[model samples]
Target: MSANDLPSLLSVALLARVGPARERLREALGQAGATLVLEEDPNTLELQVLRDAAPGAVLIALEPAIEDALERLDPVLGSPSLTLIFDEAELAARREGWEAQRWARHLVAKLHGHLDVLPPGSEQDGLLQPEPGLPTTPAQLHADAPLDFHVREAFDAAGDVPADGLYQAPDTLSEPMSLEEALAALQPPFSTPAAPSGPPPVPVSAPQTEPPRVPLGDHSSWSLVDDDAVAAVAPPPSATPSAAPPPSDFDIARLSLVDLEAERPADGAAAGAVLVLAGIGGPDALRRLLATLPAGLATPVLVHMRLDGGRYGNLVKQMARVSALPVLLAEAAEPVQAGNAYILPDDVGLAVRDRGLYFSADAQGVQVGTLPPSESAVVLLSGADAGQVDAVLALAGEGAWVAGQVGEGCYDPTAANAVVAAGMHAGEPPQLAQHIVERWGVSE
Candidate 1:
């Protein structure tokens, strides 16, 4: 099916010898707006899912009962479509980087209009070789699609941003507040009107007590209930302006690049960019994060998930349905483009080819190995790249922007320290998009 033809919601059933990989499955399916239902018995698992949603749904049964479940559901989920599976060694690998890379690769493949399952056994298991020359991989498929200049859509998907630090900025449209105005706003809600003559005297209604101050949360909304009262009693402007300098606490800028900002605008109107990073054990968090991306940003998202090659094809189809941006897997030898995302293969590292994204075998997996060029912008979902965190920092310092979700592996103090230092000194945090706009001078 075409990318746009995919469904919006999905329910997955996971069964294995051990407790189902609820967390992992949730993370992956969450990206596609799917809900994962965990159950103890495999037979009951099917009934539970059927009650909630139809079989056209995706069923992910790991290693143990995968084959049996697929065989049983083949006829039922086939017409509407169901993904039955067997074998799930990928989960046991413990190599987070490998899993994330696998996820990206699978996404690319599905986007390119191919959904072949990975056959077991062999020198190379999941990689597909198209007949003669129809670009088998997802990246290659991107080159074949249409290309158009997407304006502010950059922040929605496809690109990288600094994944650390508290970025802050001023809100451009906010007007500057004077000492009088500030004082007025801080007064109690049911206070008497101030005199309109000379500087209004401060109110005094206490024997020895001060009015409590109310704190505003991150987002605060207020309506001008007494505009007439405010306008009538408002003090007149000073006849002669004071010689003293302007107040140090005025808000004049159109946009604020505060450490707490969540999104950055694109540079000018060039192509829009978005950075996607997968996290381990909790796809729900990532999915929630992705869902909040503003609509109409046209941000092309390149995701880095830690999945197996076997599920890559299905993953892409799944992600496309839920993600704001169109999802496509990266092919063995394809070019990247706007309006489409390139998911990297398990064996490949995200890199830049002709200024677009490309994927290649990571000869040096995770730490110490040679990955795609350092300057390539990428969002690492999870893995053991602590040893190479410095290299990532160095590259980001040079020019590339990198964001990543720490994996389940034991935290590396050195890696955390290094990354924190880099973000504080060099990289930008994941949420502050406005700060990114100012620092990078991107306009969208």
Candidate 2:
């Protein structure tokens, strides 16, 4: 629909599961000025209801059973006028105060296709009222007077001085006085005289005595003690130095560069996947890192990001706008491919099988520990889960090249900070991307 054709008040079709969140969603929509044309459980909603209502937007509160509901509503997913908003049930259920306000603002913006929405009572709609009996013209206002007249009126009212003069001395200092008279007035009233001088006294003397002299011997020779006698009187050494042991023959055989190379894994097997764990501020960080990477990168990258329910589609669309690599929602049984990014959905389990990545319908905890360190690497970016820090550290210990997002760009760096404290590499997105490219022999 054209931007100008958008309505100020939107009609919404809320297809949500029956729960407390649904009622809250209804109230929020109402607050946003949206008229509820149809409200029904997502599973029971039919395509005909949507067609008849002609709602400006569709709001779906995603729950665990959302996949089935989505499958049922597949036919209407392709509508051109459909502006779908997917809010997580947990977030909606707990909306209060600021959360409710935020949701309402977002809903109104999406309905009107605008980024800026004015709050209630802020629109420019009516004329402002003037003060009662306020003058409207120059003739009605009081005539301007000189500055001196106002000063005179103020002084006269305060009774501080005469209006005709600017300065007035205090009553005590009204008359003039000589400098000598002022100095005498400031002096003390009483004074004291000096005491009489005393008579001088006489001094006494004492006698001194001299020391007796001694005679010097004619011979200068003196007796010398033997060094051997002094050594005999001293204690003997406690222990004697032992002879050094012979070096083992095994220690002489040094491992050469060839031996070290032989112990290393094959290049193909060593070049493993790069897993990116992010949350909160992940989107912008992911965008920057992905844009810098060339399409020649051989390591398959898996992104496990936390997102609100039903936002995966929008996330993919948003990432594609800035990324050079292909950004797609991961599907089950898809083989791991180089130069492609797979975003993990909340519903599925991510696993590696037969040297290929695959998704499973069975829900499981994200098993980052299973990735072989010799062939795998991980980049902890922005809002990565704090619980994954220990697992990522263990992976690093197994020879994995682990890195993290650092500096001001990373909003939630709890996981990243932990990874850094464990002696792993940390930098901005572009720097991390460069490290990956250089380590894996990627083109850029």
Best by lDDT: 2
TM-score, predicted candidate 1 vs. hidden true structure: 0.37
Per-residue lDDT tens digits for candidate 2, residues 34-105, read: 889989887877777767888777887866566566655756754656766766676578778875776688
Clashes of each: 64, 2
Quality of model 2 by C-alpha lDDT: 0.73
Whole-model Cα lDDT of every candidate shown, in order? 0.44, 0.73
Model 1: worst 10 consecutive residues (lDDT sum): 263-272
- Give per-model CA RMSD: 27.3, 19.1
**Residue 355 CA displacement from its true place in model 2, Å:** 9.8
